[model samples]
Every structure is written in structure tokens, then in C-alpha cells.
Target: MSNALRVLMAQQNFLVGDIPGNTQKVIDGANQARMQQADVVMFPELALTGYPPEDLLLRPSLETRVGQALQRLCDEVRDIYLVVGYPRMRDGKLYNMAGVIHNGQLLGEYAKQCLPNYQVFDEKRYFSEGDQPLVVPINGVPVALTVCEDIWHPGPALQAREAGAQLMLNINASPFHIDKPRHRTELLRERARQAGCPILYVNMVGGQDELVFDGGSKVVDVAGELLFSGDHFQEADYLVEFDSASGRLSCAHPSEPHPTLEQSVYNALVLGVRDYVNKNGFKGVVLGLSGGIDSALTLAVAVDALGAERVEAVMMPFRYTSSMSLEDAEAEANTLGVQYDVISIEPMFDTFMGQLADQFEGTARDTTEENLQARCRGVLLMAISNKKGYLVLTTGNKSEMAVGYSTLYGDMAGGFDVLKDVPKTLVYRLSNYRNSISPVIPQRVIDRPPSAELAPDQTDQDSLPDYDVLDRILELYVECDYSADAIIAEGFDETDVKRVIWLVDINEYKRRQAPVGVRITQRGFGRDRRYPITSGWKAGV
Candidate 1:
């Protein structure tokens, strides 16, 4: 074999704030790398303390735990060059840092210079900026070290090259959003080509809250050609061999193909649901299956995530519920092999109507009555969730949630929303995509028109714009950050554009209180995009 400094990149899933467990993970990775005859074992950012420790960084025991964890690594890792990330406290200051250790000796530490403070990152709040550059020699090859955000700009890569480094190793905990993989590939190429050195980027995978880090770890050559890559949506340990003598890198496995549009979004939802339920210690998940595309898609995602035994679908039908809906809901449950139950809300609805009869003596029936129907279903789902210890999964999609189409304390009542970031138009696409895999969703469910069934005969279009048009407007206004006039200029109907903007603006309060969900897009509702709940600003076309 040619003389090469073998590097092992561990793309792992780390639970935030689990110092002991995370430390064990690092030890295991180092051992695996040694067994593979690696010279360096490189880990993702914050591999020791986990990424985005958030307020856990403020814990009184935070520094103590980090020190103990580092000591454990120093004592245990003796043969391989171990590069691991952890939060550092030095001179009464905290910095995002990575340490180089070998043969039970702490060689040096590299504090992260760039602390990202946008989207899902708030590194500035906890970490003081590190200005020094760290370059360590492994097998006589100078390998420069950098954190996640450092490589995003040009300074760190150039600095590493200027420091006489042969290759750069950057550790990351970067979360996934739509189109991010491609964007990252291009950005890494630009950086490598500019620095004139190969780069190995290791990213953590797994879901944390709304953030899902798709461990698409990769290594590119000096000319920016990809030499190695890993699969998406799984925690993987890829042993990549980089030849320092001949500048040739190789892997045993070819790069796994990137997922398609629907697959990518669906995988994000699955990972998000799985981690949220499992990490929070929920027994399972319970959700209302209204026989509509939104609920059907959510049910399928839940089953794919937690398995049929852990997911329960309750069809809370009302007087207006159709026979077709009942059949479709049952068919979906049977196809998915999930625990299914029927809970009729007619009696509950009558009781609530009876209780409010005196107060509603004069007002004619309107959204109030429709909202009551939704609330009745919500109450049933919540009660079952409480008794069974299953977290409630809300099925409202982005198109509905963006507008005032959803009722407060009604359909919005749930522990987590699986489709909070998914638009209504995408719900149908995802449903079809899931069916294509195993045909779990009923064909009729995908073909039928969507309705709330809260009224005698109600279609969503009667209350709001068509989903195709609504989703487009939402993408422009919400995701693209366009003004009313800007969207109208895109050739949308003036009236539809105005109404959609108005609804999204007025519904900010409801969304602020809504449950969190998976974020597949760059500008999802939670950390990525934030608007004032109460504002006097008006959009004009």
C-alpha cells in the first residue's frame, strides 16, 4: 500500500447536552478508526458536548462536565490523532473549540473563529470569537483545523492554506433544508479551489427538535472534485483514506445518490418525527385521520417513523362526515397496519352546542359552528393522547396554517405538527410519493378532493384560494420574503394575492402558539423565519 495518512470521518448523531454519551461516541469512533488503520479520527463540531447546547451551556455543571469529558478522552485515546469538538471555558470566557489529542497527550486546541448567528444557529450568544489559526501535523502532513461556520467564508480556508497546510478538515453540525446539499457542494468547491488544497467536511446527522442534520459528509480534492460522500438521513462512520504522498484519496463505498424532491422532504419528516417522539420519551403518537390528504400523509409519515405498533390513528367523524371518508380512513389504517379507532363527535358536538345555545341566541351559524366541529375532534384526540401517553400529531399543512383556515385550540391542538412547514400542494405530492414506495395510502384518498367536512358540504377552496395558487403565493410571500406588490408583479391575481397576504399577516398569532414540526425548506416558520405577531404594516399592490 502507498504511504498515506488515512483519515476517518465520523458522521454521527449526537444528543444535545449528553456529555457522557457523546464522549462514549467519540471513544467508539476513535477505536473504529484505529481498527481501520487510520492516522486521524475527525469528528463533527461539538461532538463531545453535542451541537447547539443552547441554554445547557449556561448550566452550572457545564464546565465541570466538559472538563471531565476532555480528561476522559485524554486518558483513553492513546494511539490515533483524535480531533473532537467541545465547548471550552478559558480565562473566564467560552469558545466553540476542537482539540487535538494523541498518545494520552493534549497537543493543542483550535477555537472556532466564526460563530454563526442566523437561522437555527445562535453561536454568538454563547461563544466568544477565536482569532488564532490551528494547524497540526499528522504523519508529517500539516492538517489545518476549522469549525462549521469558518469555512462558509473565505478567511479560514485561506488562513489554513497560508499556514502551510496540505489539507483542511472542517467539522460541522449543519442542519438540512431544501436545496442545502447542492448549495453546500458548490460552496465547498469554491473554497477548496480558492485555497488550492483538498478539504474533508464532516457533518453530524439525526434530528434535534425541528433541525435534522443530514450527514452528507464529503471530501473533495484540490481541484474540487468529489472523492468521497456519505448517505443522507443516517448516522454513518465513513473511513476515507487520503494519500498525502500522491494526493490521491479513496473510499471503499461509492457516494450514495441524493434523494429526489419528495423523498428528501419525506425523509426529513420521518427523522424529525422519530427523534421528537423517542427523545421526549413519548410512548407513541396519536393523530386525527380525517381521510384527507394532509392527515393521510401525516399518518403514513408517523408509521414510517415509529412503526405501526407505536402509531394510532383515530378518525373522529361528525354528522357531516362522509361514508367515503370513513372507508378511506379505514383502508389507509389497514394498509399501513396501524392501530385504528373510530371516535364519533356528534354527541360531543351537540353537547357543546347545547351549552352555548343560550349565549348564541341571535347569531346565525358561521365559522363558529365549523370551529366547534374541529374542536370536538381535537378534544377527542387530546384525551386519547393523554390516556395512552402518545404525543398528538397535528395534520394542518403550511397552506392552511399560513392562512386563517385553521382554528385555534381546534385542529391546531397537538404535541407536534408533522406538516407545519409542508405546503398543501406538497402534501398531495408527498402522499403520492409514499404510496409509490409501498402503496400504504389509499388511491382514493389521493384522488378525492380535500374537504374539512365540518359543514354540510365544504371544500377548502370555498374558504380560501386554490391550493396550487395558495402555495405559490405563500412561497413568494412567506418563503421568498416578497411584498404584496412584488407577488402581484409575478402575474398572480391581484385580489387573490391581497387576500392571501392578509390572511398570512392576520394569522401570525395562531402560528406563534402552534406546535413545532419538521423544517424541510430554507425558510420554515420557526427559527429560520420570524415576523412580528402584532404589526400595523399593510401590504399594498
Candidate 2:
């Protein structure tokens, strides 16, 4: 029996639906691990097809491609045990499977037992759950295998321990949310303690549409103490040595300090934008720079994600545009070293208002004029995006999005929204966090009152509650699923709570049309929350 077992955890980023590419990555990763003297290497769940492949799993060629990929790994990889995740079909049913390949032979396979069906997961729609546990031997030490959601529950790990496993390896495609890293650590520790064995977890890193997987893979001792923690929001490989004789584990590196909440969220947004733009083949990104905190923060994020050369900021000024905004916009662009342009939207606004003069013969000036100004700016930005092959990044945050405070084809005109799921309060906090690294955003930008600048002397609070109060109410009502009365019972104003809920309920149509953004919360407005646009339900209950 071997005294020491070397395991390599491959935390990698994979493109969805790229079976052949992902296969080659697996082969390369396996060979690299073998060169590093690892006896076994483990990859993330569904690394062959990427996570949440959505409807792509239903393609007829999925099984064929997976079979060929497995064959290639078996042929090309040698002198090491490869535990990889892919989809398998048997008896007219599909399973989320992890297979062990060694020296051109398939040794064993484990199908995922727990299928997650809640927020951002629909595994039950695609896979039939496995009823049995899989325990394999590597280097004379028995090891149990489980998929992402399995470790969240206690049954699978306990089953593995009862099956004579000395160690456990769990592969995952877990997506990021605020404080999820800490939650994962606590969960793993409890699971390891319960199973009475050391557990090594490998998670994938990268952004998939609205989902950003932060790769903070971890290992915990049998006593529920952490041994090693991997990097977040990037791909890396680490080796861990397990002593079979004494049941001790040693890692090449120590756990990195966990990031602050703001840092984690900022990193997630940057990764989300970077992958979404690059993966979709955009040349760069362009956004309207209103000099408000929202656009200022968005610009900083874009520059951080794609660099100054790939990002462009345009200031579309109207009659009510402030001098302070103009100065701050240019200062911000210069500070970030991005291409800056100032285009006056007076002509476009005049043209539109003239065209609509006859139809508005009896109409009084209200939000219509304001919306027209926004539409002009939107049109200008969209034109630049079309000509430059840049993705338009909208700057509205969740507060404005919730209250229907934005125009349909106006501020919402973009292919991607940088702050779609972020609340107004958090936006300020992130801006401050970004500046703490270095002062790119001017202090005045952070200090000034936020405004749309569509009308004279307008500020956001003119029509909305204080951001602190509004954000709290939103957290309760939108994320916590608190009814209007329940929120009011939480000591919020009755009028404000009812009004906020009404706006959120009626704005489902707008949110449905809004561009997808990074989902940093468990209840972000994308896949996490699915409300009908035409529902007759009220928020009173």
C-alpha cells in the first residue's frame, strides 16, 4: 500500500458547449498533473460541457461527443488517474457523471446523486438522479466521489464514509453570490466532520452569462479545520498530499484570506463583464458616461475588466446637462485613460421633439421630455456601438430598475448591463471600494448627489426614497420575499413600502427586457426571480 497519495485539484474555466475544446483541456490538465507527480487529478463538475449548459444538453450529439472525448482522454493521458465530469446516457435516461480514467481504461463512474433545482439551477430538468454511492481506490487509499450539490447535504458523504472511504473528493460548478465562499467553507467543515474523513473540493471559475463561478476550491481535515484554500475568480492548479497511514493531509499552499464583501462583489462583476464581452466576440465596450456614480463606477469596472484601450466612454449632453457633469466625465475618462467623446444631444432631441410636435398638440411637458432626452443619448451610444463593434453597457442599478425609473429604449439601451442586479446603496459602496485601491473615480463623483440630468436641477431623491431606506426595503421585499404588509411590519413606512412594491410588480415587463448582468445576490432579477409580466396578483399579502 502506498504511504503518500498526491492529488491535483484542477480549477479551470470552460466554454459551454465546446466538447472537443474542453476534452483537450482535460487531457492537457491530466498530463500536467502527471508531470507534477500527482497520482490522481480531479476536475470540476461537467467540466467537459461547462455548467448549466441549459438546453444544449438536449442536443442529440451530446452523448456522441462525450463518448469521443472520454476515449481521447483514455488514449492521450497516461500514468495518472483522471476523475472528470461529463454527461452520460443509459437506458434512455441521462445522468450527470464523473468517470475515472487511467492508462486507456475506464475504471469506475459515479452519477450525481443530489440534483439541485432551486435558484440558478434546473438539474432535475436535464438529469435523472443516481441512487448509489461511488467509492474508488487511489494509491491504496479509498476515496469517495460526489458532485456539486451532493456535499450540501449529509447523506452522500455519510454513505461514502460507511462505504469504507478514507478520503472524499467533490467536484463542483458552484456559482458565486455574496458571502457564498464563507458559507461553503462552513458547509464543508460540517460535512467533513460528519463523514469523519478529510474532504477536497474543486470548483470551476469563469463567467457563464449572468453566472460567475468564483473558484475558491477548499480542503478540510477530518476535524473540520481548513487545510488549503484556492484562489477566487481565476483558474489555477494545486497539489495536495495525503498520508494514508496516518490520515494526515498537507497542501503546497495555505488558505488565502477571504475577500471582503465589496471586494468579492466587485471581482464578480468584473469577471462577468470580461467573459460576456470576450466570449461573445465583441471588439470592446462602449457606455454613456452621465458622470453619476452609477456610470462612473461602470466605467471603472470596464477599464478594469478590458483595459483602457478596449473601453470607450461617451458623454451625450443635453440642454440641462450640468457643467460639473461634463468636467467630471472627462476627468473620469482621462483618469482611466479611456477614449472619451462628448456629443451634444441637443440636435437629436430637437429633431425628435419637432417630429412629435404635431402628435403632442395638447400634451403638457412632463416625463415625456425627460424620456426623449434619454432616448437621444441612447441612440447616440447605440450608433457608436454599432460602428465600433463594442457592446453597449447600460449603467442603471437595481433600485432604478425596480422603480421603473428608466426609459425603455433610453438608459436601458445596451447589450449588457454592468449594474443590473446591484442596488443603489451597494453601487456607492463598490465605488468607494474600487477607489480604495487607487483613486480613479473623483471624490466629487462619489460625493455628489446622483441625478439623471434630464430636467433642470433634478436629483434621484426627487422621486425616490433615500437609497439606504430603499435598499433595505428592497432586500426585504424583493430578495427576502416579504409581502408589502410584512415589510411595513418590519418598521418601514406603509406608503413607501406599498409604493415600492407596486412599482416592482408593474416593472416586470421592463426587467424582462433589461440586459443580463452579473448576479451577485441569491435573488437577482434574472434566472433567480421569475415573475410574470401580466400577473393580476397584488403585493398586499
lDDT of each: 0.89, 0.93
Q: Could you give candidate 1's per-residue lDDT for residues 203-286 as a string of tens digits?
A: 998888888889899888999987777888988878777777787888866897677888888998999999989988999999
Highest TM-score model number: 2
Residues 81-127 of candidate 2: C-alpha lDDT, one tens digit per residue: 99999999978999999889899999999999999999999999999
TM-score of 2: 0.99
Best by lDDT: 2
Pairs of residues at least 3 apart in sequence or in different chains that clash in candidate 2: none
Score candidate 1 by TM-score against the native. 0.98
Question: What's each prediction's TM-score?
Answer: 0.98, 0.99
